[model samples]
Target: MKNTKTPDLPLSIRAIIVAFRVFFHLGWTKISKKLGTDPTTVQKFFQCMQRLANGSEDFWYLLSHIEPSGCHHPAPLIAPGSEESLEVRKAVLKHKTWMRNNAVNYERSKANLPPLKCTTVQNICLDFKHAAANPKYPKRIKRKRQPCKTALDEEDRSNWLQYTQDLEEAEAESDILTNELANKLKDQIQKLKDTVSQQQKNAESPGTLEWELLQQKNMEICAYNDAHFTPA
Candidate 1:
């Protein structure tokens, strides 16, 4: 964590707690108004504090850096010297343990409860924060988020995979056909080019007018013989 100099009093702790609130999506304006300070000043302090937390430490401690670690529902407020509080504390810890490992909605659903509002959770966090500042406050803990299960089932994934494979196979077949067509056309073009070249060479040969006419007739007869013997 970066070396940060918070005020050497409860105001500094208040500021740190406010920064934590800000990390939980609370606006700086609301916190500042409640604390009777300039909104921007509170925001500046929070940003500085976040920068100082170098992010290579405890998960809850890392919340000082504003890194997303899921919704941290504040630790339950435990009053001092209460005998009946033991069971309440156990229940609270059990619920908090779920919140720490899973998303709010997921945990709520697992407990067969309706989804809780984020604002409600934030208010609870503030209450806990106040309780934490108490002389006999116990553990300071919060919720952590877990990755949600994918919506697509096995059938959908398999269908998508097959669809992708089919497209690849079609593309590969098209490429092969395209190459074959190009090669076939290239051979035909080369044959036509050779025929043209032979005609050009024949044109330059010396001969009498009558002999040249007879030569042309003979060449035409040979061409006809060759073409007539070829397959349809």
Candidate 2:
């Protein structure tokens, strides 16, 4: 069964939220004010996200369905692996601006320094979710089963004979006393089974004391496992 626990939003989305979560960690009405987008757009973003969480979406497919204007972009038109994602580029640009203002200023701003930006890692959690749901990827190949041997090896056959002989001896030794006890247990068990079946037929609910006693008898039968008739 699939786990139903709600997972945390990805770090990229969490970072985006952090940018706008100040003051009250408020509703989209307030957060959208920080995001410079309308509250309705925020509502739709989460609506789509809830659908995605419920295993109802693919990666880019889910994003494509979102209100594109909310992110200032339409469906993905950028070539995969050819151009940086718009979100990553924005984060990188923000980092470079921060570095130029804070870090570089400690020396001399723009002192012939190379262009700076944070190296944004490609986020693949959505792809993982989509593949886990729809499974477009290949699974591991299974090995073919080998044919069974026609006959046991000599040592194995000899061991098997000894084991069987010992088992027979054990059974013979136990049988005499076990037979009489077994017959008594068998009648007692049959009575229990019939009574239990009748109790189940009579019960209004399954959890009454009579039902529990019936279940206990079934458990006892399983534990006892009669000789020959119901092999242990």
Candidate 3:
């Protein structure tokens, strides 16, 4: 069997559906029979139409077949990419704006709506109402994180490894130089200590020799004085 499902359509097509429902007063089953769609789909479309008609004067104007300024502009016939098509597109957009504004004012006049209050509280209330009537927003999906990867090429990796090896070799050389310097300092310190100890021993031996020589010289001097002259 051929698929009878109702594909999503433009607002104008939906407007025609609402017109059919309103003019004929058809139930879901009868409308579904005529449209060759499921009764459930027809019912949903009707509900959507009703909500749009109730909320929008522009939709009401579409249903009522009110033309804006007694004229309609068809879509541009030129190729969309052509320079001339830009002007045609602008005209079409301007006509649409006129249609919306004129239709809204006409519907408001017919409905006898009061002047809208511009107070802060009224604006807040309107914002809240619009928010409540809004369809549920689609939830943002979190993107899966990509796995971490190294950006290093083979040349870079080899260079880094070579640098580390060179550093180790330099450190080893520095340690050898430091040990040689320490040994040299130790030998110089030992030689200085030995020289100081020898100098101290030589100074002490001179004092002992001077004492013995002075005593011998004193005995010689006393014997000379007694031999040279008698007491007068």
Candidate 4:
């Protein structure tokens, strides 16, 4: 008989390996486009892949057995502290309260109750002070005001006004140049039109051979139009 048993791998390591293979095959661009994730995340996936490849078999075995069904529910809140740290303290207090209440109920059923010594009231002021002293917290931003302007500043204002006036004069000069060119072009066009009209009149003069030829061409065009464009 041939030995054909496959070695067992951890679910977590196997998941990471699978994830790496999928990411590697997809590449950065395709992964980013398809998943709407950054390339850095894709790069991190490759790093994870490398670690799995070099790591121990136990890691792979542990990963393969892992399942989402074992997830724990979050504890309920019971602490009554400041609004910011209320949730954290509440969770701790709720756990304490649950234990104490359960113990008292159990003892009452047995006709032997134990006095509770647990206290949930915490001094969160010290925690707040420590947090405030931490450098990670953002400092209050201060707004700076603009310095007051004096009478001597009027000279600077006048200089800016003069600069704007010079800019406007330059723009006006450009507009005048454009208008002059347009007028010149219009005059030239009109002159050309007049010259063409004079030439047409000269060609159409009575007794000219060109005039007779034009009449013959017109007659041919009329005949062609009559033949091709007749009413149905």
Provide the TM-score for each candidate, comma-separated: 0.27, 0.18, 0.27, 0.27
In terms of lDDT, model 4 sits at 0.50
Model 3: lDDT of residue 21? 71
lDDT of each: 0.55, 0.48, 0.52, 0.50
Model 2 lDDT, residue 189, Cα: 97
lDDT score, residue 80, model 4? Answer: 27
- For 105-171, candidate 2 gives per-residue lDDT tens digits of 3332344433222221222212333223323331221223244457889999999999999999999
Error of 3 at 148 (Å): 7.6
For model 3, residues 1-232, the per-residue Cα lDDT tens digits are: 9666764544554555666776777777877676667777666665654554564435465465432222223433333234332322232233343332333334445557322222321222233432233234112212233445678899999999999999999999999999999999999999999987876666456465555566567779988888886577
By lDDT, highest first, what's the ranking? 1, 3, 4, 2
- In model 2, state the lDDT of residue 133: 35
Evaluated against the true structure, the overall lDDT of model 1 is 0.55
Tens digits of per-residue lDDT for model 4, 1-232: 5322212323443365445444456565565454444555545544554554554335454354334332223434333233423432333333443443343334444545332223322322125542344343322212222344556488888998999999999999999999999999999999999987876886779777667878889999999999999989
Cα-lDDT of candidate 2: 0.48
